[model samples]
Target: MKIEILGTGCAKCKKTKEAIEKVLKQTGVEAEVIKVEDIEKIMSYGVMITPAVVIDGDVKLAGKVPDEKDIRKWIAK
Candidate 1:
């Protein structure tokens, strides 16, 4: 599974990335996690908000940080 966190390196963005990393570590899930900081790249995903989470090329969460449970559920899918 591929997980991408899109943001401009803000606090929320960093938090979002950390959340995913925490979940991955706790669950021992092997997935590629990427941080998308480029404006053009983030916009290409049609996400106008920072701190977005994309899983396997699909936008799962946007504009806010998600809880670990929610992230685990998405990662499990």
Candidate 2:
């Protein structure tokens, strides 16, 4: 699965990325996590807020860092 964390390296963005990584490790899931810092790319996803989570090219979460369990559930789906 392709997981994209969209932000300009803010604290929330980092937290979101780390949470996702921890979940991936705990679940033993092989997924690609990327940080999207490019403004154009982020805007193209229609994410006006930072710390957005995109799974498989679809926007799943945006604006804030969601709970790890929720993130894992989203990834699982």
Candidate 3:
């Protein structure tokens, strides 16, 4: 699985990445986690908000940090 976190390197963005990493470690889900900080690249996903999450090329959430519950659901295979 591929997980991409799109943001401009803000606090929320960092938290999102950390949260995802924690969940992945706890769940033992192996995935290619990427941080997309470029504006153009983030825009490519059609995400206008910072701190967005894209899983397997599909936009899952945007605007705010996701809680552990949402992160687990998104990362579940």
Candidate 4:
């Protein structure tokens, strides 16, 4: 799975990245986690907020850090 975290490297963005890593480790699923810091790239996703989670190029969550439980559900899908 390809998990992309889109942000401008803020605290929330970092937390999102870490959360994704934790989920991957717990699920034992191989995933490519990327940090999309470029404005153009993030805009392409049509996300006006930072700290967004994009799974397989699909925006999953945006604007804030989602709970770990919610993240697990997203990854499971």
Name the top lDDT candidate.
1
Span of 10 residues, lowest total lDDT, candidate 1: 68-77
**Judged by TM-score, which candidate is best?**
1
- The better candidate by lDDT, 1 or 4, is 1
lDDT of 4 by residue, 1-77 (tens): 89889999999999988988987898897888898899999999999988999998789899999788988888885
Question: Scored by CA lDDT, what does every candidate get?
Answer: 0.94, 0.93, 0.93, 0.89
Give the root-mean-square deviation of each candidate in angstroms.
0.7, 0.8, 0.7, 0.9
Count of backbone clashes for each model?
0, 0, 0, 0
Cα miss at 30, model 4 (Å)? 1.2
TM-score of 3: 0.96
Off by over 4 Å in 3: none
Write down the TM-score for model 1.
0.96
TM-score of each: 0.96, 0.96, 0.96, 0.93
> Which ten contiguous residues of candidate 3 have the minimum total lDDT?
68-77
lDDT of 1 at 42: 97
Clashing pairs in 2: none
Model 1 residue runs over 4 Å out of place are: none
lDDT tens readout by residue for model 3, 1-77: 99999999999999999999999999999999999989999999889888999999999999999899998898776
